[model samples]
Target chain A: MHEMALMGDILDIIMKDAESKGIKQFSRIDLIVGELSNAMPDALTMAFEIYKEQNAQLFTKDASLHIQFEEAISECIFCKTVYKPDFKISICPSCHMPSGKLISGETFQVLSYEGE
Target chain B: MEVKLNTNVLTNNNVAADYNRDLFHKTKTLVINVMSSPGAGKTTLLEETIKKLSKQYRIGVIEGDLATEKDADRIRQLGAKAVQINTHGGCHLDARMVVATLPEFDFEEIDILFIENVGNLVCPSGYDLGQNHKVAVLSVPEGNDKIPKYPQMFMRTELVLLNKVDLLPYLDFDVETAKEDLKGINPESTLLPLSAKTQEGMDSWYSWIDEAYQACLKQ
Candidate 1:
C-alpha cells in the first residue's frame, strides 16, 4: 500500500507510452543505478511484486519481469572531465586530486522497455 | 518489433545534482566527502582547518549526521556557510539529499565544501554525495586495524587522515601494519598521520587542501 504512493511517482512517467501499444503486460524494465543512489534492489523488487498483486486483474499469468542496471560514472566538478575511474580508480588519475563533485552515478532511469 | 519508453526515476534529483556539479565547475569549488567512525576527529580536523583557511578561501560545510545540528552550528560559528542534513535514521547522505540542500548555501561565495558524512565507514562509502573527493579519518583510539576491516573506505579515499596520533604511544595501535595494508590496497593514496586535537601535522592536512584547491583552480 505504501509502495503505491512511491511507485505512483515513477509510474506516472512510465505510463506515457504515446507511440507504442499500451502496456498489455510488463516483460522487463531497464534502470540506471548510480553508484551513489540508494536504490536497494531487494526493496524495489519487493515493492514491484506488491504492485503486481494490487493490479493483478490487468496482467497475464506468464508476464515476466526483469531488471537491468547501468553503472553510474562521475565527472570531476573541477576539471569538467568525466571521472572515468576504474572501479578501482582511487583518485583522479589526471590531476592526482583526492575527490571531486560527483557529476553522475547517482541516477535512476528507465532507459527502454520491452512490454506489451 | 519496437517499443520505446524513456523514463527516469531520479530524473528530477539528477537534474539538480548536475546543476550543482556545473556550479562547482564554473566556480572552481573543490568539494570533499569527509567520513570517519564516530569520534575520529573529522569535526575537530575541520574546525582546525577552517580556522586556518577561512581567511584565504571562502569555505562551506554540509553536516550530515543521524541527528543533531551541533556540527552545523560549529561550522557556522567558525565563519562559514553551513547546511545540516539530518538523515534521521538513514546511515548516509545520498546525492539527492546533497543536491536538495545546495540552494541553502551560496555556491558562488564558497571555494570549498566539506561534506561531513555521518560518522560511518560503510554505507556512506556506497553513496555519492556530489563531493570532489572522499576523505576518510581513522583515529588512533579506533585502532589502525580499521583499514583492513573496512577496506572499501580506505580503498576509495584520495587521502586518509590517521588522526589522534598523539594517543599512539598510549595505545596498542600498529602504524606499520596499518600502513602496509593501506598502501597495499591503495598505494597512490596520500597518508597523513596527525592529531586533530593537538594540531599535530595540520600542515600536511593543509597541504592536501591547498593542493586540491589549486587543482580546482587549474581546471
Candidate 2:
C-alpha cells in the first residue's frame, strides 16, 4: 500500500545517481525486495508506471523497471541453524526454539540500472 | 550501460528518522512509538497512561490514523497536547510525518511523546519514527496466532503490552503461552500483561516508563 511512496523515493535515487554520473537516460531499473519486507512487487511496478508517465522527461520514455525478490531466511543463533519458515513460525527446525534473526529476504534495494 | 547501485529503498526514510532522533535527543524527550492491530486497545491504553502520568510528567501524543481526529481529541480531553496526522489510506506513518509535527510540540515542556502508529500489524513495524522505544499492543481477543503470524511486528519491538487481560477469564487466551511465544520471537523483549479498562497490572507499566524516562535523562 505504501508502494507509491517507496516508488517516489526510488525515482529520486535513480535521478540523483544518474545526474552524478552524467547519464542522460536509463533503459532499465533493477530493484531487489525481500519477502519479509512486505513490499508487493506488482504494486510497486504499477506505481512506477504512473510515476514514469508523470516524469517522462527524467528518463528514457521506454525505460523499464524490474524488481527481484529475495526469499526470507531465519537463522538460529543457538544451534547455528538456518532455514526458511512459512512466514508464520520462526522456530528453529532443529532446536524448536524461536529464532527471528533474519539474515536475508528483507532486502529492499536498488541493485542496478542500465543506461543508454 | 549498466550501473551497479546497491542502495536501500528506504534510505530517505532513514535519513528523516535520524533527523527526528537528533531533535529528540537535544530536547531530552522520551518518545515511544506504539504499534498494534486496530482495536488492540492502543488508544485506550494511551488515554489511561496520560491520565496517570500527567501529574508527574508533561505528556504529548502524536496520533496517526487513516483519517480521524478522534484519537487526538481523546488525548486532548485529558488536558495534554495531542496532534493528529491523517495518512489518508496509508498503512504506516513515516519519519517525515513525525518531523512535520515536531513544531507543534513544545519539546522543552514535554517530558514524554507517544506516537500511536496507524493500526496494522505488518506495515508500522518497518518505519522508524525516531523514538526511544518501540512498544506493541496485543489484545486477548486478537488471538494467539497474531504474535507468530505477524512476526515482523513482534520481532522489532522491545515491549509487548498484552491489553485486555481482564477478559482472560472469559476468553480462552493463555497469557503464559503468549509470553512464551513472544520470547521465542524476541528473547530480549518483555511482555507486560495489563488491562486498560480495569487498570489491573498497570503499576509495572508505569514503573517501566519511569525507568525509561530516567534513562532518557542520562542520555
Best candidate, DockQ-wise? 2
Candidate 2: where is the Cα deviation over 4 Å? A59-62, A86-90, A97-100
Best-matching candidate per lDDT: 2
> What residue runs in model 1 are displaced by over 4 Å at the alpha carbon?
A1-115, B1-16
> How does residue B102 of candidate 1 score in lDDT?
75
Model 2 chain A: ten consecutive residues of lowest lDDT: A82-91
What's the count of clashing pairs in each model shown? 11, 0
Give the 10-residue window scoring lowest on summed lDDT in candidate 1 chain A: A1-10
Q: Estimate each model's TM-score.
A: 0.71, 0.94
lDDT of 2 by residue, A1-116 (tens): 78998888887887798888888777799999998787889999999889878877766778898988898888887898888866434578898877647788888999998875
DockQ of each: 0.22, 0.65
On the 0 to 100 scale, the lDDT of residue B29 in model 2 is 97
Q: Please give, for residues B1-219, the per-residue lDDT of candidate 2 as tens digits.
A: 888989999898899999999999999999999999999999999999998999999999999999979999999999999999999999999999999999998899999999999999999999988999999999999988888888889888999999999999888899889888887777888999999999999888999999999999999
